[model samples]
Target: MNSPIIQLEHINKQFKNKLAVSNLSLEIQPGSIVAILGPNGAGKTTTMKMLLGMSKPTSGKISVLGQSPNHQQVRQQIGVMLQDVSVIDGLTVREVIRMVHSYYRNPLPIDEIELLTGLSEIDLKRRAEKLSGGQKRSLNFALAMAGNPKLLFLDEPTVGMDSETRIHFWKQVRQLTQTGKTVLFTTHYLQEADEAADRIILFSEGRIIADGTPESLKSGLTKRILSFSAQHGMIPGESASPSDTQPDHNNANSPHIHIKAQIAMLPNVDQVEYRNGRWSLYTTDTDTLIRDVIQRQLPVRDIRIETGQLDDAYAELLATMKEEQ
Candidate 1:
């Protein structure tokens, strides 16, 4: 394995009265895209600022490209596209890119940068203030890439971009990684991370909640939901009594019996509904539930089980985490 391009060791950052980032540690390898995912005020932006040496860490150490973040040489090798980047309104797109390129020793060709960023239609003579939000975002990316830095920090790089432009931007990002450039970005869009990043690090309450490849994170949280529609309206209880025939009776009427057993004894159970038919019940072991229902001669329809998608896994993981908290 290659050495990590960025390493954070027991990093902690605190404001006057609150700890924005706890003792967080992370390692980002070269030539790969790593996405940092978190909700608002989760210390994601603070961590990024510390990594860029824009804010001093309250404690711990950080290294970028095997050098301290404060080192000028290391800073020169890193490109930053902050969420709140402001450009000189009077400068044109081409002028801004050229100005940024002048700071680096060997910047990429201007024509190549323009093509890679899909800024060809952006008038080179048009002032930065005249561009739309998406165009401005693309210009920011173009300026960030002008330095030809080994590592790039993009904070919500595709914010305000149209769907087509966002797709185009990811393609450009992939091209950068192909040439051994490392990308570390923060995005709220899980789908964007799924499509763009090779690895994902999820943060919550100033802590690293999860870290792995997108597929691995998804598969680890994969659940099987057995769902079907019922032909008749029958309350789904967890357990049922062998002799209990009152379908309208609330499960609270018999608190001693297991609700799961009640569900097993129901006849013609097409699906499990709870709370007066408000919510549906999904289980991993549908075979047992189905077999039990079949043995009881229940008329079930459209019973099937399959792997849940990424969105389902993501919601389940977050909900589980919230419950634990």
Candidate 2:
């Protein structure tokens, strides 16, 4: 296997009394697309800054392209599309692309960059400052490609893009990896990471909280949901006996206490809820739950099953981690 394209070892970054990133370590191979995920103030942007050599870590080490990220050669091989982009004055879109091209030894052709960015000929003729927000984002994407960098760092790269443009952007990003390039992107849109990344690294409280493929991370949660509806006053408790009924003095509008009392006995059930006259069962093993319900001959109707999504797992993991803290 080839060497890791990026590596961070026991990295820590502090700002005054606040710790931004703490004891973080991970590696990414070439040709991989990685998603760095975290809630606000979770140190994701800080880590990106360190990796880009825009800031120094308080301690530990970092490597990009098998050399210190601060090295000029490494910088030349890196492409950055930061959240805040600056538009050069007095430059038309074409002129801007050409100017960025001049900064690189051998850049991707302007035509290829235009195709990759969905830039039309008319857009190429417009002045940079006059472009709309989405247009500017596309230009930023174009600039990132201009150098033909081995590594691309994109921060919220699709924020302003329309759905069609957003889809096209990711399609182009995938094509970039086919050429052995690496991509590291951070986004508020978890679905993008779920659909695009080879791996996800989650951060919280200045540390790495979770790291794995999207499927693996989701598997960590009890992900299958079995739900069914029942008519009012019709109840199907997984293992409820008449004696199991109890009073819900605490919640007057809560589901029937008798039904709630028997929820604990459900097979493979992690959580159970009644909302909108539907019983939603949270479980890891939907098959077992389904079988148990069938054998019991419950009066439930409109049965449905749903697999857990990345956002579900993300929420669960962060809640769990917060509890541990």
Candidate 3:
């Protein structure tokens, strides 16, 4: 693989007594779309600001495009769409685009920018102050792309967009990567990361807890749910009785509870709950449970297995980190 477009080494940022970023290091490959994820106070914004030269790290090395992040020449090759940027009120959309375009010696054409960002004829004529929230975000994205940047930084770029607009915006992002542009973005929307990012880096308490392709991250969180409706009388625990189940209840003579106890003892099974004649088994290995059920002939119906999703993995990882701390 080629050298990374961006690299950070042991980056740290401190404010007063608080440490915002803690020994963080990361690399962004060329033409990759990387999504940075974390809860509040996870040093996400601080990390991005350090890379954009908007903030200085208290300690450690930072490089963008093989140069120091604050290097003058680096400015021409990068674009940023910040969540808190306020547009200048007096200019029309077209005028604002033209003004930013002038800063780059060889920027994209005004017409191409308009098309790529979904700026319409009416939008072009409207003053910056008059555009709706979604329109303003679109304008922000348009301004970022005005430089034909080699690397783009988007901080919640779809914050105000409706579902349809957000979908369209993701398409434009893919187009940029197709042309060999690198993108690093921070978003509260985990689904967006799952759908758009080539790789995801999850941060917690100012540290990276997970880093990989979305599939890889989720696959590591291997929990799956198996639900099946029992046809015979309910198992001992499946009934609403408080009485402890007799040992005989799960013996070979009693098939329902026997199968239930057998399943609960499986190597990968986590827990088993029964309600309304339906048994819900939580396990890390769904195939083993399925095969056992078939082998035991437990008279089950409407069996369903649900694989772990990215959101589930993200939550589980964060919760685990909190507990560990």
Residue pairs in candidate 1 whose N, alpha carbon or C atoms collide under 3 angstroms: 238-259, 238-260, 239-259, 239-260, 239-261, 239-262, 240-261, 240-262, 268-298, 268-299
TM-score of each: 0.78, 0.84, 0.83
Mark the regions of model 2 whose C-alpha exceeds 4 Å error after superposition. 227-280, 284-288, 299-305
Model 3, 1-325: lDDT tens digits are: 7899999999999999999999999888999999999989988988999999989999999999999988977899999999974778899888888898898988999888878658779878888888888888888898899888999999988998999989999999998999999999999999999999999999887789999999899878768888887644444444333333332353455445665766666666788877665677888879888987788666678999876678889988988887987
Q: For candidate 1, write residues 192-231 as lDDT tens digits.
A: 9988999988887788888898888876754555554333
Q: What lDDT does each candidate get?
A: 0.77, 0.85, 0.85
Arranged by TM-score with the best first, the candidates are: 2, 3, 1
lDDT of 2 by residue, 291-316 (tens): 88888766678999876788998898
Candidate 3 worst ten-residue window by lDDT: 239-248
Which 10-residue span in candidate 2 carries the lowest summed lDDT?
236-245
lDDT (Cα) of model 3: 0.85
Model 2 error, position 320 (Å):
1.4
Give the Cα-based TM-score of candidate 2 against the true structure. Answer: 0.84
Q: What C-alpha lDDT, on a 0 to 100 scale, does residue 252 get in candidate 3?
A: 55
Better of 1 and 3 by TM-score: 3
